[model samples]
Target chain A: MTLLHTIYLIAITAEAMSGAIMGMRRGMDLFGICMLGTVTALGGGTARDILLGHYPVGWIANPEYLSFTIGAAIVTAMIARHMHHLRQIFLLVDGLGLVAFTVIGCGVGLEMEAHPSIVVLAGVITGIFGGLLRDILCNQVPLVMQRELYATVALFTGVFYVGMLWLEVNSSLATLLALGSGFLFRVLAMTFGWKLPDFQGKEIRGLD
Target chain B: MTLLHTIYLIAITAEAMSGAIMGMRRGMDLFGICMLGTVTALGGGTARDILLGHYPVGWIANPEYLSFTIGAAIVTAMIARHMHHLRQIFLLVDGLGLVAFTVIGCGVGLEMEAHPSIVVLAGVITGIFGGLLRDILCNQVPLVMQRELYATVALFTGVFYVGMLWLEVNSSLATLLALGSGFLFRVLAMTFGWKLPDFQGKEIRGLD
Candidate 1:
C-alpha cells in the first residue's frame, strides 16, 4: 500500500477508538458504540463525498473500512479502563490522523477539479466533521467549533498543500510537506495550549 | 404548483420558524439563527440524498428553497414573542409537514429504484433528520429518539405509501391517502399524548 493509504488506515482506527470511548462514557450499548465509532471514522469523508457529488462513497466502495472501524471500537470498549494511560499516545495519533485526513481530502477535491478555495474547504470538512458528528451523537456542542486550534490546523494544512500544488510542487512532495508541517503545528498548538479567540456571545442578543 | 408542492413550501417555512425559535432560545446570534433554520428545513433531504448517492441534492438543485427558509427564519426572529398564541396552528402545520416530507422522500426513493425497505428508510430519514440535525447543531439529544411517536409517524407514512404503490394504487390517490392518514395519526398521537416506551438507560453500563 502507498504511504498515504497506510496512514489513512491507521488514522481511521485511531478515530474509531476515540469515538468508542466517547460512546462508552455516554453509556451507549455495544451497537451504539459501533455505530458511533463508524460514524466518527467515516462521516467526514461521507459528508465530503455527498457535498462534492462523488459517487460510491469511500466506505461504501470499500466495505473493508467498516471492519477496521467496528473492530477498533469493539476492542476499545473491551479495554477502555486500561486506555487511560495511553491518552498521550492517543492524542498524538489523533493529530496525525487529522493531518492525514486533510491532505487526503484535498487530493480528492483536486481530482474533482474544484476551485482552490473549495478544495481547501473540502479538506477542512474531511478533517473535522467526523468529530463534529461524533459530538452531535454524544449530544454536546462540537469542541472544534468552540475549543482550541483543531480546525485551524486543518485549514492551514489544506491551504499550504493547495499552495504547494499551485507552485508546481510534486504531488508526493506536497503531501509529505503538508503532513509533516500540519502534524507539527497541531502538536505545538496542543503543547502550548493555543486557542482561537472566543467571541463574546453574551453581548449578542435580541433574537430570543 | 401541485398540492404536495404547495404543502412542501408551507412545511419548510414552518420548520424554519421552529428552528429559528430554538436557536433564539439557545442565545445564538442572527447569523446562527438563519443557519440553524436553513439546516432544519433542508438537512434531512441533504442527508438522504447523500446516503442514497443521489446527485444534485434538492436544495442545491433549487436554490430558491434557501430563500424560503432564510426568509421564514428572519421573519420569525422579528416576531417570535407573539408566536406562543399560535402553538396549536404551528403543531398542526408541523404534522402536515412531517407527512408531506415522508411522501415526497418516498417518491425520490422510488425514482432511484431502491429496495422497498431502503425506500421506506429514505422516507423516514428525509422526514425527521432535519430536526435531528437541528437538535445536534443546538447541542441536544434529538427529540425524535426520545419523544412521542414522531419518527413512528414517518415510518408509518412511508410503509403505507409504499404498500399502496405496490398494490398499483394511482400515484396521486396514494399520495393523498398517505398524507391524510399520517397527519391524522400524528394529530391523534399528540392529542392523546401517546408515546413509545422509553428504555431504562441507567441500567445499561460497563462499556464506560
Candidate 2:
C-alpha cells in the first residue's frame, strides 16, 4: 500500500479503538456501544471529506472501516468487565488519533489548494471532531470546549506543518515534527491536568 | 427578502429557541448557552453547505446570524424562570424546526443541481443535523438514531417534493406539501411515542 493508504488504515484502527473504549466506559448496551463506536470512527474523517467536496464519503467508500469499528466495539463490550482505569488509555489513544488525523487533514487541504488558515482549521476539525462526537454520545460537554489546550495544540501543529511545506522543508521531517508536537503537548497536558481559562461570565440559563 | 431566505430565517429562529431551552435546562454558562444556540441555529445549514461543497460556511459567511443567535440565547435565559412545561414547547418547536429546515435544505440542493436522491438526503440531513448537534452538546443520543422514523419522514417528504418538481408542479406548493408532510409525521410520532425496532440480536461476545 502507498503511504497515504497505510496512514488511512492506521487512522481507522485508532478510531475503532477509541470508539470501543468510549462505549465500554459508558456502560452502554451492545447496540448503543456499536453506534457510538461507528460515530467516533467516522465522524472526523466524514466531516473532512464532506468539507473537501469528496463524494460517497470516506467511511461509505471503505465499508471495511465501519465493520472494523463494529468489531472493535463488540470486543470491547465483552471485555467491559475487566476494563479498569480505561479512561487513561482512551485519552492516550485519542490524542494519537488526533495527531494522525490532523497531519493528514492539513496535507490533504494543502494539496487541494486551500488557504493556510482554512487548512489549519481543517486539521483542527479532523483532530477534534471525533472526540466531540464521542463526548456527545457519552452525554458530556465536548472535551473540545472544557479540556486542556487540545484545539490550540492541534491548530499550532497544523500551522507548523503548513509552514514547513511553504518553506520547502522535507515532507517526512515536517510530518513527523508536527505529529510529535501535538502528541507531546496532549500527553503533558493529560499528565498535569492542564486546563484552559474558563469563561468567567455569568452562567446562562433556560437551555433545554 | 426572498421566500427562501425568509423561510431559512424562521428556521433559524426556531433553532435558537431549541438551543436556548437546552442550555437553560442544562445550567450552562453564558458562553455555553450562546454556543448551543449558535450550533442549533447554524449547524444544519452549515452541514448542508459543507456536504454540498459550498465555501466560507453559511454561519461564517454571515456573522450576523451568530450575533442573532447569541442575542436570542441571552433573552431566553432571562425569561426561563417564567417558562412552564418547556418540554412540550420544545417538542412542538423542534418538530416545526425540522420541517422548515427540510424545505430549505432541499431548495438549496435543487439550486445546486443535485440529483433527487441527494436532494432528499440533504433535506433529511438539514432537518436532523441541528437537533443532532443540540443533543450531542447536551450529552444525549441524537433523536434521529434513537427514533428511526425521524429522518426517514423527512427523506420521504423530500422525495415527494422533488418528484413534484420533476413533474413541473408549482415550486411553492411542492415545498409547502413537503414541509407539512414532514412536520405532521414528526409531531404525530412524538405524540404517539413511535419508534423503530430495537437491536435484539443477542449480545454476542466479540461479534463485530
Candidate 3:
C-alpha cells in the first residue's frame, strides 16, 4: 500500500474505535456499537460519494475496509480501559486523521471535476461528517458545529489544496500543504482549549 | 402531479415542521431551525437515494421541494405556539407521512431493479430516516429505533410492497396495500403506545 493508503487505514481505525468508545459511554448494545463504529469510520466518504453521485462508495469498493472498522470496534471493546490511558495519543492521531481525510476528500472532489464550491464542501463534509455521525448516535450536538477550529481547519485545508492544484502544484505537495495546515490548526485548537461561538439552548419544552 | 408526488409533498412539509418544532424545543437559532428542518424533511429520501446510488437526489431534482420544507420551518417558527395545541393532529399527520415516504421509497428501489433486500431497505430508509435525523439533532436516541412499531411498520410496508411486486400484483394495488398497512400500523402504534424493544441506556459516561 502507498503511504496515503496506510494513513487512510490509520484514520479509519482510529475513528471506528472512537465511535465504539462513544457507544460504550452511551450504554449502547453491541449492535449499536458496531453500527455506530462502522458509520463513524465510513460515513464521511459515503456522504461525499453520494453527494457527488460517485458510484460504489469507497468501503463498498473495498469491503475489507468495512472489516477493518469492525475489527477496530471489537478491539476497542476489549481494551477500553487501556485505550483511555492512551487518550492523549488518540487525540493527536485523530487530529492527524482529520487532516488526512481533508486531503483525500479534496482529491476526490477534484477528480470528479466538481465545482470549486463542491471541492471545499466535499472536504469539509469528509473531514467532519463521521464525527457528526458519532455525535448523532451518542445524542450530543455535533462537535464540529461547536468545537473550535475543526470545520474551519477543514475549509482552509480544502481551499489550500484546491488552490494549489489550480496553480498546477503537484498532487503530493498539495496534499502535504493540506495535511500540515489542518493538523496544526487542530492540534493548536485542542491544546489551547479553543471553542467556536455557540447558540444558547433554551430548552423550551414547547409542544410542536 | 401524481398521487405519490402529492403525498410526498405533504410528508416533507409535515416532517419539516416537526423538525422546526424540535429546534424550538432545543432553543436552536434560526440557522439550526432551517438546517434540522431541511434534514428532517429530506434526510430519509437522501439516505435512500444515496444507498441505492440514485442520482440527482430528490431535492436536487426539484429544488422547490427543499424550499417547501424551508417554508414550513419558517412558518413553524412563527406559529410554534399555535401548532403546539394541535399536537394530536400533528401526530396523526406524521403517521400518514411515514406511510407516504415508505411507498415512494419502495417505488424508487423497485425502479432500480434492486435486490429484494434492497427494496425493503429502501422503504424503511425512506420512512424513518428523516425522523432519525430530527431526533439526532434534538439530542435523543432515535425515537424510531426505540419506539414500538415505527421501523417495524416501515419494514413491513417495504416487504408488502416488494412482495406484491414479486408476486406480479398490479402496481397500483401493491402501492395501496403498502400505504394502507403502513399508515394503519403507525396510527395504531401511536395510539396504543406500541414500541420496539430497545437496549436500556445506563447513562454510563464511560471512557469515550
TM-score of chain A of each: 0.98, 0.84, 0.92
lDDT of 3 by residue, B1-208 (tens): 2777888888789889888878766666564676678899899999898788798678755667867888998888777766767788777777778888888888888889988898888988999999887777777778776657878888888888888988999988888878888888888877788777656568656687
**lDDT values for all models:** 0.88, 0.73, 0.81
Per-residue CA lDDT of model 3 for A1-208, tens digit only, reads 2666788899999999999999988888888888889999899998888877877799989999989999999888888877888899888888888888888887787787766756776787798889887887676877664446777777778888899889999888878877888788888888898664333335333443
Cα lDDT tens digits, model 2, B58-133, are 6545656766777877776666565544657666666666777777788878888898888888888888788788
| DockQ, prediction 2 | 0.15
- Which of candidates 1 and 2 reaches a greater lDDT? 1
**Once superposed on the true structure, which residue ranges of model 1 sit more than 4 Å away at CA?**
A1-54, A58-132, A141-208, B206-208
Determine which window of 10 residues in candidate 1 chain A has minimal summed lDDT. A26-35
Q: Write the per-residue lDDT of candidate 1 for residues B47-111, one digit (tens) a residue.
A: 88888888789999999999999999999999999998989999999999999999999888888
- Candidate 3 stretches with Cα past 4 Å from truth are A26-36, A136-142, A145-147, A203-207, B1-38, B51-53, B58-132, B141-208
Per-candidate TM-scores read: 0.61, 0.59, 0.61
Please state the error at residue A54 of candidate 3 in Å: 2.7
Can you write out model 1's per-residue Cα lDDT over A1-208, one digit (the tens) per residue?
2998999999999899888777766666565576678889999998898889887678756668888998998898777777767888889989999999999999889999999999999999999999998888888778899989999999999999999999999989999999999999999999999999988898988685
Q: Best by lDDT, which number?
A: 1
RMSD values, in order shown: 7.0, 8.0, 7.4
Question: Clashing residue pairs, candidate 3?
Answer: B148-B195, B148-B196
